[model samples]
Target chain A: MGTNPVPNKKLAIFTATGCRACENAILDIHYQVSSLARCADIAFWPYMLGSEVRDLEKQESIDVCFFAGAIRTSSDREAALKLREKSRIMVACGACAAFGGMPGLVNISQWSVVSGQSQRTMDNKQQTNEEEKPELPPLESRVLGLPQIVKVDYLVPGCPPTQNFLWAAIQSLVCNGQSPARLSFAASRLPEAIAQAITSGILPPKGSIFAGEKAVCASCSRVKEEKRFETYKRPYQAYEELGRCLLEQGLVCQGITTQEGCGGLCTAMGQPCRGCFGKAEAIFDPGAKMVSAISSTFDSNDAQEIAALVDDIVDLVGTFYRYTLPTQCALFSTPSKD
Target chain B: MSDFEPKIIAFLCTWCAYVAADTAGIARYKQKPNVRVIRVLCSGMVDPNYVLKAFASGADAVLVGGCHPGDCHYISGNIKAMRRAPLLRKLLEEMGVENGRFRLEWIAASDAPQYAEIINQMSEEVRSLGPFSPSTIK
Candidate 1:
């Protein structure tokens, strides 16, 4: 299924304004595709001298289009469509373009903002409770990233995807004629480097396990505590316990469950992995991760009780997922076409 | 202490809280006549801003009542409602409204007695919070 080698591949790196993350991603993409520099012509928008080639007539036509932000404006949609029309391959260049990244969160939370205006109208009391909400500002006024408004050919999810993932995507498309998901990180690189230093050989490539899924959990060991109990009267601040798996520590994993990617950075820094990787497989769901991490830490728990515990954790953390997604994560809110 | 009776707005879920309010009326559970109830399909459908709007529009207080968790006629509607309640309460509190002025209760379709109790408790709480002033409007 490989297409003919594009001898004169034109790669246009499309980016929106005010995103440092997109800038970082483009730099990484440039590094990976440097080998193709002779055959490929890459250009960036807004910052780069992209205005010269803004229309189709001026420069070399694009063969591969890399989008960097969640597409918000009609112009953005037009840009994506035009790029698709010109390019043979379209890649959601970074996390922002891929899942709608942080921009999708804006879309979800937008309801609240609209509701806020609704409150103002209600306060104004124009003699009707059924009054229509004020019209949302034009798409340009909203800070929509790419996927929010257009269809993406490939995704690389992360606040900014790791260099390896971004490189892998470009190499796959360039060298292998395939496009993979905008993966947060390449599983190939992990605790192995540390394991190599510790064990004098690479760690068994198998890091910690969560719910029988082979994803690594930095706080896996702590969750295996043999005894568990619940006390309801603690303060909200009491939820913070240093160095224990959040669930094992009897706190919510709001960060890990809601945020995507990174070896659960907050967990590594001695905080619970809040569910930041929204509704991921059990390997990532903080509740599911806890069941595995804690079950491994402790022994002999009532199965039914454990199930109930998981449900309660889901109930608590689910809000975090919902909060993060519609308001922040691009994967949930980015329209499929965008 | 103007002679004006405070206005209260209640957003009730159709399947549970709305039915419970209807039952309260049917069973002759006379509570505050100042409360106006608007029934929605589900409590989750009552957006937080709508409740806030009620307050901005001269409502001294706003009450949202839904089916108990897991008992939502539309499965998980009450859970969504529950999640929103605490946040809205916090929001109102930060905006300088007394925490008790905005309330969220879980009342089942058969809980007519509980409906009466909640309305009475909320009406009393609103009464103590005093008359609505446009100064709080934002």
Candidate 2:
């Protein structure tokens, strides 16, 4: 993606508050990046290939912009609004941008999280006598999804989006929705759904999330057996065979409400669904739906038993609303026309 | 605070709390008449989003009243509510909502006087707590 940052149809990427895994996800598209690059230019990605602050300050309109972080600080909001102003199509690319992702957990408390980290940094600095790092810009009280701050045309929903699906999205956008005559070779290298999506060449309407409409369970290869919620298993604890569904084994799988389209990537690897792909279509509150789904599935109806079933759920908010919490303000805050 | 009347949105379970409120009305009980009730088939029917929506849409507070733990009409709907309430409360608190702004209680069908008393108490408590600004929600 960075090898030749020549100017063509302008494409820009902006990071506000994220781990930069999404940038790595784009890089993981490997050789396909060059083919996509042939169609467009990398206008202002400051992450890998360096760009001066003045270079971004003088930036003009862009064809497509991928914003990959939650709007945390005033600077982040300014960047988002600026990106919205300059881009023809703005995509929230990754869970942080689309639904607040890991960074949103800091909203648990405005002061404590940031202060705790800064305090730790102080301790580390004292130990090493290291040169002072640049201080971060002050955070807004809440983390916000891209859609909340400004209108977003599309969302690539994932902690870091699935590589093949991301490729398909870029290629489709580059081709202007028509399947390229030269896709069979690349399609053969992708997953079936991504291959079909690229080959079929139908552009979804604006504001569509680039993920499956159904829950991640639909794409998971694991067999669903009995839902015996006897105990909640922590990540460090031993788990059952990879063949069986992780949710049925009481591992806090969020597939029931999480949108698929990562091709069940984590679940396929025996990890439970963390709902990084935002709420599946038609679901309102991802956490509440998950609570209802799992609470009802417990083997025993006894109060103490149910509590026991949930006792191991250390971070209920993180487990269920890890990616969707920032989106919750839109879920119910506005009065519905009931 | 004397003139501050709280706007409460109650999601009452049809089997228990809804009927209790009806009986409170028929029995001529003295209650603070502030709550706008949306009767659900079961307490479990009220997703956390509904409570958030109620507060977001200008309500001062939200109360979710249902059957007692073992008395659920759906055998286990109230049990599910039990599991969700505390965590939902924590989530709301994280979003800058005060914990007292949400109340989860059990109201039996025959507990008309009790229902009236609870309503009066919640209304008075919220009135003292002052109006909740919806702008702080986001």
Candidate 3:
């Protein structure tokens, strides 16, 4: 009797305009690396596999592509288009690909001046062989999240999504979550319901975020109390209250409006949540949501008092839209075909 | 720029600003026909996304008209809008939205003249700014 055989899925790891930490996160999956290796064949990971001849133009169609990083350079955009053409399932891994991570701050600052500064700061270049280093391509006008450049099937959000959430996404995509999701840091640490759903062996709907739907505040292990803000301070200024909600301490925690799944990693370590996870459910703009959500909790509703209260927020854009400006900003998003 | 009739997207709160618009229209108050109004339940309900979307889709100006502070029927809805407007304005400006392109003002239900005057003022401001060219932002 002949049995139906399933071919292994071809997975490509593509990266551009990022810190390359997402690639490391994938490798840091440590104990489960073999499980992932067994589930899919590495088709074209130029960064790690050292397999040159990137001419993906001739390779058989790739099954899934883990695309990490923003499209910042002409070469990056070109490669993204080529990868899109060759791959069937495109997963935007990490915040840069999904929402233009910290690097996206260049979108606000003068990108040209920034690039100019970079050239002046490359003092260590003489140590390396002059011809060995690749010429850095001129950056495009502004950084754009993956969706801005091409169609994206799914987004795994994070600065570089936590090792757990990312591994979950890979497992879900390749194994249909048939394998147990529970591990020391991967699934066992997640809220029970989320862990259950991820490990249920069902492929989530397309366009789904491979993270918790709840706001980061839900997972934040901080003592909750009524919040009535009178003053806002930078994290450095707050020296006393260490364990209470950062927002209550006026440290500008975005967890109240941010979608969770990193397990409030930064907030857990006495730092405010930077909202690397994009918008929470039903939030159209995290900035607008944060303003409304935070302002309502203010102790004083008086106009003068409130105006002063708002002045304490040092960088309004960096606080809420830190990760999402590229896709949400009208500047780049307008010309898209979507 | 003299003949330019800029497109303004106005998010008017239903209780006050929307009522003022209706009153101005019924009373035959002279107001520029440039503004395209989107009425919301409360000024606070107009998410910054709405304003950002308006600009994204080619709105020349965005006017968020709400009730005067303490005049909100829902108690403190305008207060919330008050809280968000300045920060949203700063954020949008940082993203390259010109000043005059984004505004939030209190218009009472009975202030039809003020509503008409405000529209004319906004139209003039936007006209002077020469239509929102997002290119300058980059």
Candidate 4:
């Protein structure tokens, strides 16, 4: 047993229909890419190395599998199931894998209806012959995050997870002898010395979030005054005022209900949070919790007035559950009986 | 359609709505028998998840009852519930849950007649709306 010694950790990267950003995140690790390459053998990465699924299946076991993308089709689901089974630790990478990402908004309507509508639009616009049209696989009834289909040991939360967080997670597992209970970018926002000091401590319980326990509002720099709003404004409808809370200014910033981990980057830049990080601890549904927060800020308790205020929000599902519709407990999709 | 009976899950505030239900029974007020009630300490305590869970678990409709705004035993608990009610309705509407399947009413402890009226009226409305479909729970 001692003869072989220094067993290399085998790593696999799986991406399904996700933006190329996930692949870029791996490359963006800069000089660490060499260290990562040295420490872990890249067993399979379909996007970069053009490895086949059969290659992954042939591996005895994968030490870590980094999966990115929502499971949108039958093939995606099949790949996710296979990768999950082959890996010892499966890390759901990026917003698409951890939550459902923007694609989850498709849950508002049936898949057939969505596909049919698109088909009709293409038919009218192009007037293409049947042979000219490219065939697309049938979409699953609902988009699903990785954890929805199989167990996920870790989540790297970002549109495409930041290279620092990805590197930190990999470094810890390779060198520290244990993965951090939860690995998030919250600490990465701090000065490098402080971030390192904070992360070096004992970790929280397993399954705990790697992000800040508080809502994004706690870390946000906006001034908070009375939260009364008579009307809501869409991001495009009005110019945001500087140094004021977006919600107080009548914009539906979801920071009050969203977990803090993105370093309030969007809010700092005067844009409302889209809640890509999912719910804070103890919150089952980020959308519902946001509804409670926004509704409570209304100036009136009268039903009609409240309804009027809510009407200002265009596309309620997209506004509330934009990034999290798939994993939310209150939102589920089942095949129709008919 | 006429034979359809709606199943309603009523979350009654312990201080007011629950007492009102007790008073309705004592006074022998005629009310719809389709309602099943769960009492909570305050209407403010009704997490929106409970209402969603009730609907998802196959209740045809959900009714949340709280004290009249100013009369809440916890000062502004009913007002808090009032604020949350419309938001919950908006969420339900977005999920394609039909109108009248979820309602919130303010009932004082003394208002047994009003309680009975709301239950009967909700039951009738939900009966016309038909059984809650599982697919719309999302």
Candidate 5:
């Protein structure tokens, strides 16, 4: 038989510590690309060569790259660019890598705060101490995630995306001509048979879609319809009762529509899922998750009425989405006067 | 009076805090029984969430003891920790927790007495604040 050509490919995966999504992606990659795994190498953070991965402008030759952390600081962006340069294909692996994740939510507020502080410090210096300093005051900066900084190739959206996606992507790269097929679920929930097939090494057929959107309050079987309230009584207490949807059961959904996977972990626990799946497709303008949800819940025509209704859920949003709220979203609290 | 004991959680760097704590114990320094110490390789290894989780799970106070800025066993690890701690302190303040509830103290490996003082001061502050009720946690 004629000699079979071996695929020439190298892979390196970078991740942040304590990131479950990155950990999961690594595991999925192991299973999916087991056949040609030797071609790909993995590098965890800090262990990466050089003082800063981002400092290296042009990365050496490689085939695929996966960055699995929130690229908030300039250092992370530097690291990402290096990885993108080294690879023929690049992908931002988790929620943070994809659209800034929780860190992005802090960008607007953090910048303003830093700017305000620097301005105050400068004014104070100019008044109190006339000693010569730098010609211009130093500008303060905060971390902004990927997509905020660089042009990303592909985004696997998830607080952590599923392992299936990770492996599928890697396997597609190394297999060259043997791109594996991907299966899709109609609802967020994966079917038992499909789950088993995925676990058993049975490559899913391409173009498969699974459909089931049953986790949100709107999908809850226990809701009596008429019991659904327009606003929450006491937001924190709204997540306590099981066997009832939070919204339909007189509680706010806590941005459940934004997150996918976990079959609605918060809803199942009687709590709401804060939109941890990055941002939903249509709401790209800042604070889209809250804005869209608020609009959908009230009479869009009456801005005053909507604001009052939103105020009821404000505490809920703050408590449930604290780390994820960019100051911009906070400022976007009321309907715009203009 | 014993019931007024504070529940303190100390995150010590393996190279410095752990050694300093050991030195204090070996020197027979009397420390309050309330402080629970956790040893990590470097202060940089300590996640801000770990400190937050400690408070959420019932720590009356949290202490991060590391080497002096340039004295870090792992070079810039302590510096990064310094950067992280103050921000965490700010976050705690915003959440309405007493600002003194979280402390970042630099102690050399030989400074066992300094380590002892930190625990004593932290305990006193926590005790003065009284118990941390669930309602007190944001």
Candidate 6:
């Protein structure tokens, strides 16, 4: 391990929605907390400290800012923009920030359908002239990842990145004077200082992913044989046999198309991959690519028969674009008319 | 409206449909000139992205041509393509694309007249449906 030339660099941790896990991830540093504290100053952390948005805005700059959550609303976008302005290196710190997470599945339905009920309820309450309430910020029609709104230097992708990977990122930044390679998912989107490294060929290509080059199936520990499925099975419908590939058994495991990360943890635990790590290299639409791959594996050739086989999938959009709907090409819809 | 000419993207499988297209040309079969044929190795090789991209980039309709069952050069490539067609159509429908904008047909190498007929029918159908405005999608 190397040492930082300038210690006590300022750090910020910004949370939006689904960020409770990242809050815990900070303490997950555990015994190494002291080591982290010794090198960098926690200049701002809204959840753990008294610092507010105004306080963060007051700072001239921060060495690193870890933003966790999907940009579902205007406020989230505001925070992301503010943090981007203040931080030298911005990291999208969780799945919600990296790939839109579970919230992105809302992309399947029309934007009005997803948010209309709440808007109607709010309108009804306002009409009653009850106690004064703070005006709510408008929501974006689509749930977007941090990178969709602002330049993100790194992405620590997981529902909450594993504690070990989190520590390695901090250690590499503080101890080695460089960001961890595993955390450099969107290095091309970095600001001047970091982008220069890629432009000058010191770092890897601009859009190089920090994780393993292969798809999750390459790292999966299950026994995979020739794949041919007569029917699709949802996880809740059956007991999956141990050590057998979930996809080979007709469960829609996304391992074959998902970028490798999280050590194939969900697959190891007998559940299919939800594709939170996003598409593998050379893949543009994670959902469509998986759909194509899965479709190719079906046993039948008759269009009616294949449609019947596919009809078994309860929610096509939810199943395929579980975490990546916002960025999926086929799901792109025009903005709401309202 | 009467002069509406649809812009069609026809993905022709090299072993069967491409040959049929050439035969149609040589035989002087009268077919709609609106269809732009892109020769691919096999219909199974047509990724959904190509179709989606074609629609996104302003194609009025996409026509995928493959070998009839048991006629595929790569053994079961057309079978794989058959399995994929329905799913791709379903996905397109979910995205709010109008029905009949995508068609999958099997054209044998010797069936030049049939190939010309299908293209003419598809061109007429897509023309009636009008231009595909994917404005709802970004």
Q: Which candidate is the best by DockQ?
A: 4
- Model 2 / residue A250 / CA error / Å: 1.5
TM-score against native, each model: 0.48, 0.83, 0.84, 0.84, 0.47, 0.86
Candidate 5 — which residues are off by over 4 angstroms? A1-8, A16-21, A28-39, A43-59, A110-112, A115-142, A173-227, A230-236, A239-243, A254-265, A284-312, A315-338, B1-138
Task: Answer with 3 or 5, whichever has the higher DockQ.
Answer: 3
Indicate the docking level reached by candidate 5: incorrect
The number of clashing residue pairs in each candidate reads: 43, 0, 0, 0, 14, 1
Q: Model 4: which residue pairs collide?
A: none
Candidate 2, A1-338: lDDT as tens digits: 36534345678877888888888898898997776677777888889667533476677778888899888887898888888888888888999988877777766554566767866876786677657655566667677778888988888888888887677667655544333555654455444555576577644567767777788888899999866667667655746687988877777788888887887888888888888888888777776677667765677656567656555566666667777766754332222111
Residue A238 displacement in candidate 3 (angstroms)? 2.3
Per-residue CA lDDT of model 1 for B74-124, tens digit only, reads: 897766565455545544453456788878788999999999988888877
**Worst 10-residue lDDT window, candidate 5 chain A:** A329-338
Candidate 6: segments with Cα more than 4 A from true spot: A1-5, A17-19, A112-115, A127-129, A132-134, A174-208, A328-338, B1-5, B128-130, B133-135
DockQ of 1: 0.02
Q: Sort every candidate by TM-score, greatest first.
A: 6, 4, 3, 2, 1, 5
Q: Which candidate is the best by lDDT?
A: 3
lDDT of 5 by residue, A11-121 (tens): 666763226556555665554546545544443233344234543344457566666766544445556666766666666666666544565444334356766876788
DockQ (C-alpha based) per candidate is 0.02, 0.32, 0.48, 0.52, 0.01, 0.46
Worst ten-residue run, lDDT, model 5 chain B? Answer: B129-138
Q: Which of the two candidates, 2 or 3, achieves a greater DockQ against the reference?
A: 3
Which has the better DockQ: candidate 4, or candidate 6? 4
Interface RMSD of 6: 2.5
RMSD of each: 14.1, 4.9, 4.2, 4.9, 24.9, 5.2
Query: For candidate 6, lDDT tens digit of each residue in A193-238?
Result: 4434544435433333345557889889999888788988888765
Q: Comparing candidate 2 with candidate 6, which one achieves the higher DockQ?
A: 6
Cα-based RMSD of candidate 3: 4.2
Error of 4 at B97 (Å): 1.4
Give TM-score values for chain A, per-prediction. 0.54, 0.83, 0.83, 0.81, 0.60, 0.83
Which candidate do you rate higher for TM-score, 1 or 3? 3
